[model samples]
Target: MSKRNQKNRQKQKVNYIGGRKSFVRILEEMNEQDPNLIRFYKEVHWSRKKGCFITDTAEHNYKLMLERLDETEVNTENNNEKCNAAFKEVLGHRSGYAKELGHSVIPEPSIALHKNRDYLRIVEENERNKN
Candidate 1:
């Protein structure tokens, strides 16, 4: 609050996107010493220790990531299969949608969904959010 202290305070203007604000120290170090610190500025930072990705500390983290990735692929494939089954069932209904439900269909239907793509997309998104 003193005039001398006020004079010592510097004014700064800043803008940031996606919550990735620059640190004051890093800013000062942009033309800085320590090449390793410069390397830090260039890399994308993950709050979770990234050696966990490659190091497998307890081995659990690595396993968990692999599990999630595997589950994602499985779910995608399962959804495609379910959609195809739905398309097949719709064809069986003789509801005049057989052509729309077949291999001829550009976009296939899922096991429990209607023809409109948005509805299926919404269902999938909701499921993902819940998980």
Candidate 2:
């Protein structure tokens, strides 16, 4: 094998290790034509070799693409009326906001914690009053 092919095979690392060009071609074909092929292949051929694998049927690269798409995201300028407008206009409601995991916006840890804290505080106060 040539050095370039060797390099490609090596780069396929987590999956597709020995099938680089064909691997990428499959991705393009699925994206351009039909996405169900990816799902079917993954359902049939996916492997635990990559911890990121969601199913055993998908082709290696197709699974990787799904992972990338799931984790991918969009950029926003702000979190206000203008931002909301842009989100609606450019992104639409349920289209491009989420990553593969399906969340368009990831809430900050602090925000989640604060909400949790508020809920706990309310519960504690209510319990104390009852006692």
Candidate 3:
């Protein structure tokens, strides 16, 4: 190919990559700010006039993006559950230790409420008091 043609191809490649990256980044920000908007985007069909023109490739990318978003949400929930369980286990050990030492044990917070940062801080403060 001529040098001019090669340059054109390189420019097109860069534009394609940049466009795809920006699309994903924008979607992530939108998801973080308002997940309902992402859901609406996924559900609404776009037309050339009403919404932005969407090609077959763009449609496929949208599907993939939604799938990734859903997977990420599920993974996050699982991680949070695991973290809460670990916290509960630690609290259990602390309570047992206090019982052994004849120190009055602080009442454990409900499992559902353990996700609160304030609750975690209170537990940490109680531990420090014991030490």
Candidate 4:
């Protein structure tokens, strides 16, 4: 074989170690500081053996994790909408009262709404129990 052909073959060769490192590096990069992505990466049972992630079990589990993450995001968005509507309703009622009394009522300090982490934990526990 010519030197050029040998060089081409070497260039085409797969570096398994480098490829493995890149696979993990790419996943980390795609995480983009999202809590869900971070949790998914941390929780998943990544195998050290070559080709383990391509197995049927690993693929199915990964798909399920992705679906769960999507569902959680949708649920969070829905909850946020509900919270905003409720807050608006409360503010409207307060404003109407102030207007009826013909006085400038001092507005109360706004309390920031936050999701209860324990609620999520309970829901997850219940789901696991159901399964």
Q: After superposition, how far is residue 86 of candidate 1 from its true place, in Å?
A: 1.3
TM-score of every candidate: 0.15, 0.21, 0.24, 0.23
Off by over 4 Å in 3: 1-52, 74-131
For 11-83, candidate 4 gives per-residue lDDT tens digits of 7422233344443454455446542332333233344664455345445545555554445445664654443
Q: Give per-residue lDDT, candidate 1, residue 94.
A: 41
User: 76, model 1: CA deviation in Å?
Assistant: 2.6
Quick one: ranking by lDDT, best first?
A: 3, 2, 4, 1
Model 1 C-alpha lDDT versus the unseen true structure:
0.40
- lDDT of candidate 3? 0.48
Per-residue lDDT over 1-131 for candidate 3, one digit per residue giving the tens place of the 0 to 100 score? 69999888766411222233444454456557553333334333345354642455445545555554545445554654443343333323344443323223445658878898988899799999999
- Residue 95, model 3, lDDT: 41
Between the candidate structures 2 and 4, which one is better when assessed by TM-score?
4
TM-score, structure 4 vs. true: 0.23
Provide the lDDT at 116 for model 4. 60
Kindly state the number of residue pairs that clash in model 2: 14
lDDT per residue (tens digit) for residues 23-121 in model 2: 345544554654343343453345456554543422345635555444435344322333234323432356434343232254344556656978779
